[model samples]
Target: MASIFSRIVAGEIPSYKVAEDDRHYAFLDISPVAAGHTLVIPKREVDYIFDLSDEEYADLQLFAKKVAGAIKKAVPCKRVGVAVMGLEVPHAHIHLVPINREADMNFFGEHLSMQPEEMASMAASIAAAME
Candidate 1:
């Protein structure tokens, strides 16, 4: 069975996509730690981020850098924080969270609840910033 992230890449699942390339995808986290908390993942499924090839890892980071910049521009935050906690889902991914403080990136804390319209608008703003 495909991981949920793969399902999203395949269009079997809906996502608030912010950016994409031939090999990577960026989307808003449904249970976000912050307003613009986004997840960046490889189109190819890999259980661990470190398990990816050197080239794959490099490319993923570069793609993520672009997404992070967009998030910073679209969201009101001092900086965009990066985190890697692969246990939540099988797919290897990076979390690009908009944070004004260190605590803003807390994964174990209560997640922000966002309405569908809010999510869509945020995604659109980030996607536009990517251009």
Candidate 2:
């Protein structure tokens, strides 16, 4: 069975996509830690981020950097924080969160419940801000 991330990439699942390239996909986190919080993942499924090949790891980071830049522009925050906790889903992924303080990136804390319209608007803004 495909991981949920893979299903999103394949269009079997809906996502508020922020950006994408041939090798990567960036989308909003449904249970976001903050507004404009996004998840970046490889189109190819890998259980662990470290398990990815050196080249794959480098490319993923580069793709994430672009997404982070866009997120910073689209979201109101001091900086965009990066986190790599891969336990939530089987697929390896990175979280790019807009944060004004260190505590804003807390993954264990309560997540924001964003309406569909809000998520759609945020995703569109981030995608437009992409370089």
- Model 1 gets an lDDT of 0.97
Question: How well is each residue in 49-79 modelled by candidate 2, as lDDT tens digits?
Answer: 9999999999999999999999999999999
Measured by TM-score, how close is model 2 to the native structure?
Answer: 0.98
Candidate 1: minimum summed lDDT over ten consecutive residues — where? 83-92
lDDT of 1 at 47: 92
What tens-digit string does per-residue lDDT give for candidate 1 at 1-131? 89999999999999999999999999999999999999999999999999999999999999999999999999999999999886968999999999999999888899999999999999999999999
Q: In candidate 1, which residue pairs get closer than 3 Å at backbone N, Cα or C atoms, i.e. clash?
A: none
Candidate 2 residue 125 Cα shift, in angstroms, is: 0.3
Candidate 2: residue 97 lDDT (0-100): 97
Error of 1 at 29 (Å): 0.2
For each candidate in the order shown, give its overall lDDT on alpha carbons. 0.97, 0.97
- How many backbone clashes can be found in candidate 1? 0
Candidate 1 stretches greater than 4 Å from native: none
Question: What's model 2's lDDT at 115?
Answer: 99
